[model samples]
Target: MSPAKSRHLNPKKLIRSKWTSASPRNKEKHFIVTNIIQPESKDLPIDLIELEAVYSGRSFALSWRELTNTQDWLQGWR
Candidate 1:
């Protein structure tokens, strides 16, 4: 059976949440939310999400909406 749809999430609550990439790169598939980049100005909105690779200790930022795409990301460690 196909996996369930990823949830409509709140970025503010995603700190420390785990994620798994649908496709592995350099055998690194596991990741975790390390930080939710704070909006620099009150007039701005948060748009970037930070994740750390559990395998390599490398961190990167991406659009938070990308997490909702099941084709590229899974909701938990898998």
Candidate 2:
């Protein structure tokens, strides 16, 4: 068997054991702290101001251009 397939055979446990150990209030505080620390993506308006494409000989060719300041352009791939 392949290494990747063998890894999937292992049983997985998803219990939050620490939650039972901690008090109810402590769990809430933990969640709040974790949420604050978690990185969030800011939804910024993008202006698709200009789009230019060239097609020599094809049935259908589609190209797109948008105005965005994001470091990585391909948002859908992510």
Candidate 3:
């Protein structure tokens, strides 16, 4: 099978964005971007983001870049 196309994402506008997992676990299929982790040094770029499960209220941190991987995440609720 061919690889999934990566989704376009603007890091600056990631906050409050919604997403859906392509393969969900724990019934946490829908999620929202709740936080953007800031770098300790002002010169550094954003790297991590916090995602909260809409169904379970659970949250976790992951690299923002991971969202670009279409195989794992979709841009909006699906």
Candidate 4:
């Protein structure tokens, strides 16, 4: 596997992790992982996660890999 593919990501551990968007919408920069949508079977990989805006109580779903993009998302709140 390539370096990125070899990297380990524990989906169950992602819950409650904080995040910050590089480009804030409606001035909401801070967010948290509120929910992790798991696959129907454990053998399947995780595909989506729900992020809640700390300032607005808004939530949205996104592909988990999007969080790995430093240009778009910082791992912790900033």
Candidate 5:
């Protein structure tokens, strides 16, 4: 199976645990996932979130469909 298909079916759970300083040469924030959820878990996560420091010249954004009337986490940013 393709990675995209697997991701759509059930996103692999990942434990995001640290942040690195962004530099002039590197505009994107680098994230390290510490661990991954087992295959037998329940509903997959809606989206994987990443925290970016705007002061460091990096901004991360997320947009999602209304899957089952879930609450929005980015309301304050809008």
Candidate 6:
């Protein structure tokens, strides 16, 4: 099998972005970037973000880099 195609993501522009899970569970396929977790130290880069499910209004924190893995996530609603 070929390698999964990954999406190019810019962490600075992730807020309010839309996404679709490749393998959705509990019918929570659509999601939006609700918030970007601020780093405790100014020198630290952004590493986490909050994703809110459109179907269930559930929110959770996740590594921003995980969105780059197209095998698990798509850039927009699909």
* Per-candidate count of clashing residue pairs (backbone under 3 Å): 0, 0, 0, 0, 0, 0
- What is the TM-score of each predicted model, taking all chains together? 0.87, 0.13, 0.93, 0.82, 0.22, 0.93
TM-score of 4: 0.82
For candidate 1, lDDT tens digit of each residue in 1-78? 787477698988889999999998987899999999988897887788899999999999988989988989998999
TM-score for candidate 1, residues paired by index: 0.87
Clash pairs, candidate 1, are none
- Candidate 3 local lDDT, 1-78, one digit each (tens): 998788777777999999999999999999999999898998999999999999999999989999999999998899
lDDT of 5 by residue, 1-78 (tens): 332111122223333433343222355434333334333445654453434443354545322221111231211122
Tens digit of per-residue lDDT, candidate 2, span 1-49: 3321111111112111111112223222121101111124445322112
Give, for candidate 4, the lowest lDDT window spanning 10 residues. 1-10
Sorted by TM-score (best first), the order is: 3, 6, 1, 4, 5, 2
Off by over 4 Å in 3: none
lDDT of 6 by residue, 1-78 (tens): 898887778888999999999999999999999999999998999999999999999999999999988899998899
lDDT (Cα) of model 6? 0.94
- Candidate 4 per-residue lDDT, tens place, 7-41, comes to 24577788999988989989799999999998899
Q: Which is the winner by TM-score between candidate 1 and candidate 3?
A: 3
Sort all candidates by lDDT, best to worst.
6, 3, 1, 4, 5, 2
